[model samples]
Target: MDDDEVLLRGRVYGTDDGAPDSRPLPGRSYRELVGGPLDGLLLDVTGWDAGQLSGGAALMTELGRYGGGGRAHYGPRAGDPRCWDWAGDTP
Candidate 1:
């Protein structure tokens, strides 16, 4: 996938808050946050075919795996990490 697609997914999967902030996350590319701050990442898959969704999911899964271990540094800093943790075995 291209850098733009990776960045777009990163932003979408990073934060939950709708509030705007100028502080950029570590290892995050500025190019991704361009076009003014986004309330949330919006993907319009209105006409996407099943194949397309499958492809997109595969891409996202790979991207998530690539960056998965870096979650501590990449995820939201203020909220409970458990909220974003998807690996289970939470205390």
Candidate 2:
């Protein structure tokens, strides 16, 4: 599927056992994703539409710009395309 047609799953940056870890997207929605800062984003989806991915991307951008990590991947394991850049190309 296309990059825009993916259910992007985001994991906010957090500490685990005194170490850095990632947590699931608070609400998995644009509003929820922006609730706070995020550490990174991953496309945790089998299939989705453009709106969903776009929304996730938007939140990722916000998190990245607001001192939160902006790392992104396009795969079930967040390891494709190397990185994500919504600002350069919005859906």
TM-scores for candidates 1 onward, in order: 0.21, 0.23
Model 2 bad stretches (over 4 Å): 1-40, 50-56, 60-63, 67-83, 88-91
User: lDDT tens digits, residues 3-91, model 2?
Assistant: 42222234432323222334444444222221222323333333557655444443334333343434432221134332443433122
lDDT of 1 by residue, 1-91 (tens): 4554544443444334343432345453232211212212333334556555333321123233345332111222134321221231111
Query: What does the lDDT read for residue 43 in candidate 1?
Result: 30
Model 1's TM-score against the true structure: 0.21
Q: Using alpha carbons, what is the TM-score of model 2?
A: 0.23
Q: Cα RMSD to native, each candidate?
A: 14.4, 11.9
CA lDDT of 42 in candidate 1?
37
Best by TM-score: 2
Give me the displacement of residue 14 in model 1, in angstroms.
17
Query: Relative to the unseen true structure, what is the C-alpha lDDT of residue 49 in candidate 2, on a scale of 0 to 100?
Result: 70
